[model samples]
Target: MKTQDIFVLGLTTFALFLGAGNLIFPPAMGLDAGTSLTSAMAGFLITAVGLPAFTIIVLGRIGNTNNLTKALPKWLGTTFWVLLFTAIGPAFGMPRAVTVAYEMGIQPFFTNDHLVAFSIIFSAVTLFLAFKPGNLVTYIGKIMTPALIILLCGLGLAAFLSPLGTPAAPSGDYQVGAVTSGLIQGYMTMDAIAAVGFGWVIIHAIKAKGVTTQQGIASTSIKVALIYAALMASCYIVMGYVGATSTSIAEHGVNGSVILTRYVAGEFGHYGQWLLAAIILMACLTTTVGLTNACAEYYQDTFKASFGFTATVIVVLTGVIANFGLNDILKVSLPAILVLCPVAIALVLASLAASTFTVSRLTHSAVLITATLFGTIDAINILGKMPKDLGDFFSDTLPLYNAHAGWLLPSLFMLITTAMIGRTASAEKKFGRVDYRLKTANND
Candidate 1:
């Protein structure tokens, strides 16, 4: 594809990935990282930026998510598919998108009384667009995404030209393990799952451009990913800078949205608030539409449900839950994220290296099992689902447990061991001496 076409494709991918959480998480993380902001951001970029980029490329290479899941057993794959769509759909991500759009966008313009009304209208538009998924590239990518970028760039530039204040001292886990804590925070975004959920849109967009071959898709995806990575990195840096500097002016313990709201007001005065709100509104709208469409497509494909039925289910569920607001939804979301992200990451990594490592179904299963096992422990700890003693045991036993990446080593071990076993078994079947006595007996 030409550069212009590639840019348009990149915009859709970027908009889909750069949702409410993308806006919310980085700034708060920077505040927490404080003096360790650089190190923390580096780690954050690994998963927050890295995993999502990897996911899109992997999906592009593999053709679609259905093909990607072929690495796992049938039942497990089905379960994962269902869980992934739900987690990123109305159950969690879509609601966050709705709430964030309201809290950051329309809420500032209106009183609390209008929240219900705003949410209904927002979800109604989202549902309408979701039902017409094919035109998303044009609606979001060509129109809203460009506007979002322009507003964000203006805000970031203004912030950089004049920072809030010097960053405060590192606090909490950041004082000791800033990078690790950042990685944990990145994992918390659960964007790896979002990438998977939203990626099909990009794949379809690419195919629409008439690039059908695997190599063609993968190469085009790289260009698209580079654009996405650059945009995300730049935005994160600017947002983190804003948050880090706000330590002096803003109260401690405020969320990113509040910090950003205050900072924009401080920077550009009344008009800045509207500008920031517009940026957030566009961001959330793009994400909400993408996720709703993805959810509808998933259900329609998997269960043969009508697109309108699935879209209704998604929009209605999201609308109802969004009224609960961001914090309450986050309380439910974080644990599920902790459980799902590791498995998704492991699957992506294993698939990427499948040819080189001789990764088999067994390998994928073992890795996912190990990841899910530790991931559950992490989730349980987060939710306080297990006894203190059990949580303590898990934390103490696992390396990098405190980093929220304790699942990494065990999953890697399982992947390697299973791959070796699979390779050896394949070798035996292919090259080992035949059982001549059994062959002769069968002939007799």
Candidate 2:
């Protein structure tokens, strides 16, 4: 792809990932972290920006989401794909975007009574834009994303020029293990899951730009991921700084939207409020459009449904779910997000390793299975569904259990063990009653 085309694709990728949690979580974390902002932000950037970029790079080599679990059985792959797409689509992600936009952008200016009308209008616009999935790069990357960036940059500049106050001392979880706290908080963004879902759109976009070869696709994807990471990291740092310094103006423990609103209003007054409103609306709208398009396409291809019908259904579902309010949506979604994120991380890492090493299907399955088992236990504990004694036992026995990531070590161990076993089996079969040099030369 040409340099300009790559740049545009990068903007689209950035916009697609910059949705509800991306806008909210960092500021709230920064507020809590305060003096510990550097360590907390470091952990936040790892999962929020780094994981998603790494996911894109892996998918670029492996092909789209359908290829993600190809090593598994057909039924298992389909089930995993369905769950992943649903989690990042109409079920949680898309609705969360609508609610965030409504709460932050429209609710502050208007009354709560306007939620129904706002949802309808918001979904309608998303539906219209999503109807032409082919034009997403042009519509979002070329147009909406630039405007959103400009507004965000303005807010960032104001935050930098004027000081709010010295950051307060770190509190609660941030008082200790701030990095782990931030890393867990980053899971709320759900961008890694979105990256898997958005892989098809991006690959198609690159192909549309005449990059059809696997090497070309992977190369372009790296460039896009770098650009996306740079933009996301900058925004997170600026927003975290704004939140950290706003203790004098805004109270702690409030949602990030409120903290940001207070900071912007204090800095720029009424006009600044409007600027924030514009920024939230644009960010959420682009994400909703990209998600709707990606999900609708998935359904159309997988289930043989009509694209228009699927799009309409997804939009309507998102609008209805948005009425549940942001806090409620987040509360309900957290358990599921917690369960899926570790598994997604494991899958990304396994895929990367498979691309480099001679890995077997059993290795991939074992790693993911370990991740899923532990991840489910973590979710159960979080939801208070597990027995207190059992939960405490696991927490005490498992490393990083307090961080909501008890699955990592076990998954890594499973990968290494299963990979070694597979390699041994292959070696034995190849060396059985045969000269290694003769076989190697014949194969070559």
Candidate 3:
């Protein structure tokens, strides 16, 4: 595609990936990172922007959505995709999107009844926009995304010009390993998992633009990745800086959202609240539309269900779940996100390198299984208590457990070991066949 085409595609991709957490997390990181803003944002960008961009490239190579499932064993693939869709769609993602819109956009001005009413209206609009898959890029990229960016730019500029204060002392997790904490926090965004869901949306959009063939897809994906990385990294840096300098509000605010709301109100006076609300709603709505469409497409393809049926199911289920509100949804969904993120990251990285390495089915299975097990333990540790001794043992023995990257080493070792074994087996089989052919020729 041309420059304009790639630019629009980038806009669409950016809209799809930026959910409530993307909006909320960075500033909080900045608040904690304080003086370490540069290192922390750099680290955050790796997992948050870099990993997701890489996942998009991997999906482009595979060409279409179902091919992601081909990376693992058949049943496992199906199960993973199903669970993934749930995690990023109705169960946690969609409802969270709805709540973010309501909380940030509407809550201060309205009552609980009004929030519920707005959610229904929000779900209806999402379902309406979701029905026409081809229009997703046009709706989000051409229309909603521009408005969102303009709003963010205004807010970012205002914050940048008026200094909040010098960044306070590094606090909590940022005090020790700010970069590592930022890395893990970036991982927690779970955008890689969302990318898996959003990949097909991107491919379809590219196809709609008349770009076919693996080479074209790969090229376009590269362009999209560059745009996504640049755009997201810039936003994160600004937001993190804003958070770092928010020492005055830091006493009153515990999270990025709180800090942002206060800053906007302070900066723009009465109008800031309305501007912030609009920005939050736009951010949440775009993500909702993208996710609903992606999940609907997946279900239609896999279960042989109609698109209308699937989309309706997703929207309705999501609407009902949203009533549980944001905190509860996060509580239930955080564990799943923690466990699946490592698995998703591992899958994308392994698949991208599969052509260069002697990657076996065993390698896929072993690495995923190992990562899942460790990730589950990590997830459980988040919600409730693990045995003190066991937790201590793992935290001390594992290389990066304290960094929330305990799964990395185990997954890497399994991938290498299984690949080597598979390569050796293939070599031995080839030699045996050659020897048998020689023996047959001698007898002749």
Candidate 4:
């Protein structure tokens, strides 16, 4: 990739990653984390940037998403990816975008009447983008990102001119779990899901600026990711700092977007309000477009729907769903995230755990079995009714589980154990070494 290719790809990747969720989640987590912002930021970066970049770079290296997805056992890998992105888009994400757009973008105009009208307006704008899906990265680069930057700059400057007093330390035991909360909040951002799809988008961005060959594209994407991630990390650091310090917005237990707008306004007056409105609108629009386009592409591949029709249907459906309201979206979304996040983390991070291990199919199978079983139980325990004794037993007596994630520890143990055994078996059969089962799948 040439110099311009790297620059454009980096900007495109940044556009892909930034969103209203990104802005909203980090601040709230920071607000609660207080003095723990450093640790929380570390955890957030691991999941938000590290894991996401891992997903995209790995996919770029592989060069074929279908093969990458298909390489996993029983088709679980792709299904997990699909379900995650779908949830991030239609189920929770789009609606959040709608309401956020209403609060931050449209509220300034109507002040009273805007909420109802803005919901419809936000959905309509999203619908237009979804209907006219194009090369997503390029489209954002050409239009959406410039608008986003102007707005962000205005807000940042406004915040600089007038400041909210540093916030107080977190209340109660929640302070102890700030790192864990940041990790969980990272899941809500859906960066891992974006990681799966944006690799191709990154490649396209690179190639458009003139990159060719899988190796070249992969190398360039990594460079771009590194640069983009650093900038994003800086943004998180600043926002986290702001949230940690700011005391102007009284804790109403309101939504993050509401908190953000009120905080800005209290600090910088009406100018901050106007600037934030533009930022939210632009970010939401870019996110909505990128997500809808990705959904269209995946579905077209799966069901033979023409790209145009598939994209249109996704936009309209999600837009209509936005009428449901932001707070309502948050309720169901949190439950779903608790279900999907661990599995997504497992799948993406397994490649990193033993990067040299090449047992493609067996590794995928083992991780899927371990994670899915555990994730389901974890979700059920958290979100659904289960017998008291049964829950306690699983939480306490299970090999490597807890009330929170009875699946996580056990699942990890299971995958590593299975992979080692499979490796031994493979090695023994091939080299007449030992008859250890690890030889079977370990080499992979």
Candidate 5:
């Protein structure tokens, strides 16, 4: 690909990742972290930026998310894929984008009564844009993303030049283990899962730009991931700073959207609110379009449905779900995300290891199964559904249980144990060992 083409593709990928949670979470985290913002932001970037970028690179090498599960049993692999796409598609992600755009972008200035109407309009636009997947790169990269970035840059610049207030004292979880708190907060963005779901879209875009070979695709994906990570990290830092300084304008523990609106209003009055609205709308709309396109394509391929029909169904579903409101949507999404993210991480890491080592189907199954089991526990704990005794036991016994990452150690243990066992079996076969009965008979 040409230098210009790579930049455009990178911009498109960046826009796709920059959506509802991406905009809101950073600032909310920063507000809580206050003086501890640096350490907290560091932790946030690891999962928010690093993991998503890593996922894209891995997907490039593996072809698509389907390849991540090709080694697993057919039923299990298909189940994983379907659940992942559903979570990040109309079920949670796409609808969340619509709600965020409305609440943050439209509701603050206008009447809060228009969410359903706004959702209908938003879904229509998303459907129209998603109707042609091929045009996403042109639509988002060349047009919408640039405008969104410029508006954001202006807000960031103002926040830096004219401060809102000095950073407030750290609050709540930010007062202790702020980094870990930030890490868990980053998990809520769900961008890593988006990367997996968006794999086919990115791959097709790269192919469309004349990069056909596996090596070419991998190389280009690395470049694009780097660009996407850089853009996201930069925005997060700026937004975090804006949040940290807005203590004078908004109370600590307020919604991130509230913090942002107050900051923009303080800085540039009514016009600034308009600018912020435009920023939120563009950010959410681009994401909705990208997600709808990707999800529609996946359905079309998997079920042999027409693209138009799938796209229309997804849009209608997203619109209806958006009316459930942002808070309710988030309440439902958090548990789902907690359950899905660890398994997705395991898949990404397992795929990377497979590229370099002789990973067996058994090893893959062990790692993913361990992740799923522990991830369910984490989700139950988060929902307060786990028994108090069981939750306390896991919290005290598990390494990162309190940090919402209890799955990591168990998953790693399974990976190593299964891998070593597979290695031993391979070595036994290589050394010309026959069946145990034959060897015993010969010795007798």
Candidate 6:
């Protein structure tokens, strides 16, 4: 609860969420987005910085996290977590971590068939880490992140000194819809969903310090969570900008991951590339471990009856599927991330809404269910395996899906409707009129 404790714990929490996206995705986006990259970066920051930060605060305030979506109606809540966690793990999260590692780490050594090797090794290690997650917080959060940071700092500094190339023509690439692209890349960060995943770990870390009082526990948790959010937010913006300015190096026709690695190598040479590779791999390892651990924890929690038995199964299954290849994981996960991301955004907004109803179980659940239905439909469409009739029905009947933004309006509508209901309920219960009492803290 003390300010100093907040500092240390905040660093630990931030380190967990600062995965591959926090380190590499933004910079790649910035390189591609170019001048318009800033706007896109801004959009990226909304979900990346804003949502994740809000999640920490919400979890801290509510002091309860059965499941991020489990707060919703029964079937819907289960659906939400399954979709979110699955998308992040086997489909996307773990895959992305493997990707960043290959791009940054193993590629230098075994660039040929690197994707194949990267997919296998990355998944294998993450499975190994999660299979025995004992002291993972200490092993990963304490040890790995520091090394990851050193590597990133070196790469970041190298890029700063020599520069890679001028940023791409952002005005053209990002012009069509800079905001949307940035927002989409922001989803790549997965900070908001991570909040739910990391919330309990943080709580336990704090609770271990023996702060037992309810009020005291929340106060301390918020201070640290907020700080962690800020640290992560800074990283997102920097990487995005780095990506934005990488147009000159495009001639190499490099893969997105190669852009930064090449940039580092160009500036620092062979030894620098080796260091960069190590850092990139380590950074990704930290993230990969976090994702597997989060998914495993939830699976174990959901199947408490099986406990160790079930956790082992979940880890093994994901790792094996991962061996199918990194590209496979990315291809499958794209739809899931695109589908669930909007609903995730809606949850963050509603969770942080000033109104008690928006913040309450009743309203949050109602809104989440509506969004989940739309998101599921949207996801089905993207992944391209939907039942013919169902897909046609949602598209024909739903005005929004035609634009590929089905979840947006529905989520907003739910929030407004639920807020109105909450307002009415609040007045009836004598919880007072909206007096505009506010809690202020800068968050993503």
Query: Against the unseen true structure, what C-alpha lDDT does each candidate score?
Result: 0.82, 0.85, 0.84, 0.67, 0.86, 0.66
After superposition, the stretches of candidate 4 with alpha carbons farther than 4 Å from their true spots are 73-78, 111-124, 127-135, 157-161, 177-181, 203-212, 252-254, 326-337, 350-355, 381-406, 432-444
Index of the highest-TM-score prediction:
3
What are the candidates' C-alpha RMSDs? Answer: 3.0, 2.9, 1.8, 5.2, 3.1, 8.0
1 or 4: which has the higher TM-score?
1
* Candidate 3 structure quality by residue, lDDT tens digits, 1-444: 778878988998888887777888988888888888888888899988888898998888766767655767789998988889999899999998998888888988865467678889999999999999888888988899899889889988987899677798788877778788788888878788888889878888888889889888878888897887788888788788878878877752388899889888878989999998998888899999999988988888788999998999999999999997768877877788879888887777667656466666676777789889988877766656678888899888978776677888888888788888878888898999999999999999
| lDDT (C-alpha) at residue 250 in model 2 | 74
Task: Predict model 3's lDDT versus the native.
Answer: 0.84
| Winner of 2 and 6 under TM-score | 2
Q: Candidate 6 on 240-278: residue-level lDDT in tens?
A: 655655666553234556666656656677786787677
Each model's TM-score, in the order given? 0.92, 0.94, 0.95, 0.83, 0.94, 0.78
Q: Which lDDT tens digits does candidate 2 get at residues 243-328?
A: 89889887779889888888888999888789888999999999899988888888887889899999999899989988877578
Worst 10 contiguous positions by lDDT, candidate 3: 352-361
Candidate 1 C-alpha lDDT tens digits along 18-132: 8867887878888877778999998888878888988988877777667767878789898988888888887888888887787778777775557788889999988887788
State which candidate, 2 or 6, has the greater lDDT: 2
Against the correct fold, how does model 3 do in TM-score? 0.95
Greater-lDDT candidate between 1 and 3:
3
lDDT of 2 at 407: 87
Better of 4 and 6 by lDDT: 4
- Ten consecutive residues with minimal summed lDDT in candidate 1? 429-438
